[model samples]
Target: MKKFAVIALTEGGAQTARCLQEQLATQGFKVEVILPQRLAREREIYYRKGDFNSTMHRLFREYNCVVCIMATGIVVRALTGVVVDKTVDPAVIVMDEKARHVISMLSGHVGGANEWTRLIARLMEAEPVITTATDTEKVQALDVLTKKVNGWYPNFKENTKKINRRLAEGKAVELFIEPYLEKYVEQFNGFTLIRDIESHRGGTPLVIVSDHTGFAKNADIIHVVPQLNVLGVGCRKDVPIAMMQTAFTEFCQQHQLLWQSIVKVASIDVKKHEAAIQYLAKTLNADLEFYTAKELQKVSQKYPESAFVLKTVGVGNVACAAADYASGEQNVTQRYANHEITMALSRLHEI
Candidate 1:
């Protein structure tokens, strides 16, 4: 819940202001109203009573945002001392006496006032006022990406500020992609996918399709940090409603592996709702996007039209090709399941 100091400019406005504050407070807002006149008897609210302008500045510093039941333009003009910094300012929103609508006049971007106004408008049946480049574009929050990546513990304030700076300045941020076997590199699988690429750096030399080594020191190539990432999957014969998950995890523990190395689970398009697979992916905090049966069918090279796969599922095959169709390549870097099936891993650089 957000804390707001509602400044009531007039005595008559205090009741309406308290009502509005309660309206927001009921919607999980902790609001403390400052009635400059006198605290009312019907609806008593506690606040530090004082000069409106100075008190508002103090409240602005104390709270996430401020809500006022008064004329916004007049309030803004009264606080000529408050707009000292373009950045690092509190979000301030003003609602009219009747609380018909909310206006985001100043500090719309830096203060995150626009989003707060939207929430306020939503609860009070008021219109949210928004006008900012990033908001207008509806950019995805970097925090969401941080949440999606298991290993990414972000420095939110610093990272977002730098990212925002780069975005504002139109700078390019480079990411590197590398895929290799964990046993070969002695590192986690798929951990090298999002490594930063630099002008020049060293890397674990790669062995080709076979066990062969390539030199990076003598080669003319830029330096890149390899982030390994692999998608491991197990599904029903034809992905029959999400049971493939148990088989996949069983495959993982059957072999010795931690789930963090696996990015997402996969299956033929028909397995989209496979319960066990979906639950497993959700448990691992990963995604279960599928490809066509023809994709994974490529792995084993021979999966005749199964009466089960065809009747039970629309897909006609169960080869690694089918998994690869949804995943990528015939790359079964790790395999399990009585040798009859595999919990394969695929690497992807981009969405």
Candidate 2:
């Protein structure tokens, strides 16, 4: 569940916070109210008697998003020492005491403050104060697009503001799309499709949509990797996380696959609780799925088998079978295994 922190100081702010908590709860948010010592009433209120800034700092570290129903100046001053990078910072929104306006204060784009602002404003019938250039200009934001298509932005730390500024100025951007995504390119504006690399002239921001990795990087190029790959992993119970990471990276690099394109890490149900595989999945922010030995046996790929593996796990080919089951693809990479771990990859067709 999405966690939300609502900080309120006054009686009027507490009333607004309660109303917002009810509305947001219906939409599946876990909203918690943080109140000053004197204003605490309900059992749910987190009453802090000491410094407000310290309380806010702790809340900012704990919650996914924070809403302040107080003066904008107060919110800004309270967060001065706790603010971090946009990619990792939690979304922060400020609302007027009367709920007449909702402002997206920080982490508007990547952290989804702008989107939350719109949702809260619509629910409360208040005016949304979005100051982001792309939002104000109605330009399609790159971060939003990447999230929608399950793509990864490799150079977001370096190139986000530059690309958004170009788009805000209505400058044309160049897009290199895989044939499967050609039909969907019309949804974006200010983009000219480049059919061939030789035919491309270089005067605009570039977006490349593909599953390959290590494309040449330029200041203007943004590599968008679609989440089209699934990895089936088999490992000894005591395999180390570092060894798994090395094996996974080498496999992707050898196959020319983008490590970021991996959407799921699959394995037999018995190895579902393996720490190394779980750590790898958490690092990629992908789903970890486990299939029963019976379910894996149903996949009819002609994978190489081991009698010892079959005797141990009831499936002769764990990696290939799990990959086929997870990605619904018959093709798989050759088994790449170290002494401790085994991995195979499968690519899914574009939707």
Candidate with the greatest lDDT versus the true structure: 2
Error of 1 at 86 (Å): 5.7
Q: How accurate locally, in lDDT, is each candidate?
A: 0.54, 0.82
lDDT string for model 1 (103-130, tens) is 8765665465776788778877877766
Residue-level lDDT for 233 in candidate 1: 50
TM-score of each: 0.41, 0.75
lDDT string for model 2 (209-259, tens) is 888766677776788887877899898777888899888888877888877
lDDT of 1 at 221: 26
Q: What's the CA RMSD for each of the models?
A: 14.0, 4.9
Clashing pairs in 2: none
Q: Distance (Å) between predicted and true CA of 215, model 2? A: 4.2
